[model samples]
Target: MFEYSIKENCLTNKTILVTGAGAGIGKEAAITYAKLGATVILLGKTVKKLEAVYDEIIALGLAEPAIVPLDLKGATKQNYIDMSSTIASQFGKLDGALLNASTLGELTPFTQIHEQVFSDVMQVNVNAQYLLAQALIPTLLLTEKASLVFTSSSVGSQGRAYWGPYSISKFATEGLMQVIADEYENSSLRTNAINPGATNTNMRASAFPAEDKEKLATTADIMPLYVYLMSDDSLAVNGQTIKAQ
Candidate 1:
């Protein structure tokens, strides 16, 4: 796992947004950020799950988190625009955004890939990310140091036999990260991708049903990379796809 020695309250007064905040790694990241003194915005499709996380954050006496229930699959460009505008209005600036929402789509041979499944994965994994970032750029740029973290996988860089749409979407994700990072190289905004290797997430279970979950790394184990990318410590690192294993 990527290791970093983060101090207490490292993220104080920072307002960070996390997608897929309802469960798994996203849930851990959101709570972790709050614990570190960041006021987090939990963005996810499930209201109940978001509420659960929100309640947990409040109970822990951490920063109060907000919930934005949104389904990336069906959200429009205007939705992202408004969301970004609201974040700017309410928070003054967005210090970081962890774009972690994604779909597994069935793993299948390239020739056997279903049209609908491919479209669904691309919509959530690629298009929504692009639109959200586009809308959030102005707000992100407003902050002195802004981190934009995109989630990736091992298949993002290399092709695998049964990964299909998920693999192709991750390749595009890396491409997107590089393009934005290069464009914003000298700006206040920093862009990067984190390929969280084989964590014991619900998504992981679906990907490898037969594997033993006990041996896989948990969300807590991979958060160092997550925190490092979002902290000022990584200001010099951009346009890189780092692996958390």
Candidate 2:
């Protein structure tokens, strides 16, 4: 499982939607899927960043990708439903979806947590994911085999001192994954979560301001696990939380 390589056409004839695709792990995952022959839908809040990724994928002569500018913080259920409908009409089915977008609200003490801050965190991390997954389930079921990967965190499994809302949101994410996984236990769609441990992303930098970025793994280095989870080879592996190091 650790030594697998994504075949050049492993994801050929498939379509994948990746949230937070404008930067960091999301951007890298989107590009990786395109390189492995999947038509990728890049969803993010920034149009320019998504376009940059789109252009890079095109330049690589990989699959052509689509761009969806979405702000999960403000996105409504209807927006997700409409997007899902459009995807169903255009692609017929969605092969996979990476729910990678997240917000790292203020890392304050739990005692000082405010209402708006907590709501904002939960909105992007939990509420939006629930809505998006609900909308995309129909399209995912249409696929021969489909994967739904959520981005989890270390704090989700074990509470930490200063992680606050981000931590709570991740805990909710894991709970959601378990609920959805159980719901689809007998179906073709599989749901799972991954904790990209201490990677070299802006989020990491923000979370650990004093840490040395040079000591951490780059986004590219951790993609094999992401690719493996999204590929057909992992068809039997579902409903589990994995660490991508």
Candidate 3:
């Protein structure tokens, strides 16, 4: 598992947005960030799930979390604009964002991949991220320091058979991170990518159904790096892809 010694309340007064906050790593990261003193904005497709996470945060006496039920597959660039506008009006500026939401298309042979599945996977995993970043970059610049963390996969770093469009989208994700990171190297904004290798997420279960999930690392196990990247501790780290496993 990854290790990073983050100080208590390291994210105090920070306003961070997390995509895919309804479940899995996104849910855990949202709650964890709130506990560490960052006001979390939870964006996902299901209101019920987001509300559950919201309730958990509130119950724990953590920073109040806001829920935005958004389906990334259909969200337009204007939707992201409105989201950033709302964030600016309410929080003044966004301190960080975790672009963790992604879709896993069928694990089939490269030739067997369907067009619609390919498009759907690319829309959520790559295009939505691009739109979100485009909209949030301006708000992110308003802060003295800001971080944009993209969730990557092990297959993204290296091509593998049967990974299909999901793998291709992740490769695009890594490229997106590096491009944005280089673009803002001289600015307050920082972009980085994290590969949560072998985490016991629902998505992981879907990808490797026959594998024993008991041996996989939990979301809590890899949270140190998540918190560290968003906190001031990693302000100098940019454009690099870190593996959390």
CA lDDT of every candidate = 0.95, 0.93, 0.94
Segments of candidate 1 deviating more than 4 angstroms: none
Misplaced by over 4 Å in model 3 are: none
Scored against the true structure, residue 154 in model 3 reaches a CA lDDT of: 89
Which lDDT tens digits does candidate 3 get at residues 124-234?
999999999999999999899999999999899899999979999999999999999999999999999999999998999998899998999999999988998999989
Ranking by lDDT: 1, 3, 2
Candidate 2, residues 129-230, lDDT tens digits: the string is: 999999999999999899999999999999998788999999999999999999999999999999998899998899889999999999998898899989
lDDT of 1 by residue, 1-245 (tens): 67788778888998999999999999999999999889999999999999999999999988789899999999999999999999999999999999999999998989999999999999999999999999999999989999999999999999899999999999999999999999999999999999999999999999899999999999999998998888888999999999987
TM-score of 3: 0.99
- The TM-score values for the models, in the order shown, are 0.99, 0.98, 0.99
Consecutive 10-residue window with the lowest summed lDDT within model 3: 1-10
Q: On a 0 to 100 scale, what is the lDDT of residue 44 in model 1?
A: 100
